[model samples]
Target: MIDGVRAILIGDATLTGLVSTKIYPVSAPQKINPPLIVLIRKDADPNKCKTESGGVGRLDEIDFTVLIMSLSYGECETISERIRFLLDGFQGISNSKDLDIEYETEFDSYSEQAKLYVKNATYTAWYKT
Candidate 1:
């Protein structure tokens, strides 16, 4: 599920044109360039059972935190907006895996150590495994 979601986000032309292959799954590299995206799985819980069988389900409600980091605030905002536009309310098959994504705006801030602008977007992704 994580790999499928990462592939979908990384395959976006707008995002790739901006940051290329700088999309990290859990953590970014020690020395990362500006305008990168990091995907973190914040929390996950099993969805309500459909059948009477207790553990016979394949769906999960997963929350992901997408962090957009850039050198300037404007760039960060633009990238974050593009990511939201690309991912919000998206439902389809990615890499032959079934998934549904619903996103919400989280928060934005600035990092003093790296001198980077940061934007965090939270997504509720329902994945079938």
Candidate 2:
């Protein structure tokens, strides 16, 4: 599912203008440029599914945490906004599978160690398995 999220974010011109294919899964490389996007898979569980056959279909509910990190707080905010606009309430085909994504929660923090302002956004995505 992280691949799907990366596809959506990187596919957007607005977001690419800001990050320029800097989206990474889990974490970015050391000393890389700032104002990048990182995707983290939090967890996944089976959700009750239904089909016309009156049988339970394979449906999975996954939680993903997206981190917008940048040396400048303003840049972080800009990237965060673009990501939110693209991902919130998004339902479509991604990675050759149908997906339903929704924004769940977010928070702002400063990582003094990395010296980057971070905007953490979490989303719930449901898809057939």
Best by TM-score: 2
The collision pairs in model 2 are none
Taking the tens digit of each residue's C-alpha lDDT, what string does model 1 give over 28-73?
Answer: 9988788899999989887655645656666888999999999988
Question: Against the hidden true structure, what lDDT does model 1 obtain?
Answer: 0.85
RMSD of each: 2.5, 1.3
Flag regions of model 2 displaced more than 4 Å. 52-55
Backbone clashes, candidate 1: 0
- Residue 113 local lDDT, model 1: 91
Q: Please tell me which predicted candidate would have the highest lDDT against the true structure.
A: 2
State how far residue 7 of model 1 sits from its true place (Å).
1.0
Q: Give lDDT per model, in order.
A: 0.85, 0.90
TM-scores, one per candidate: 0.90, 0.93
Candidate 1 Cα errors over 4 Å, as ranges = 51-56
Candidate 2 CA-lDDT value: 0.90
lDDT of 2 by residue, 24-70 (tens): 99989988888888999999998787877999887899999999999
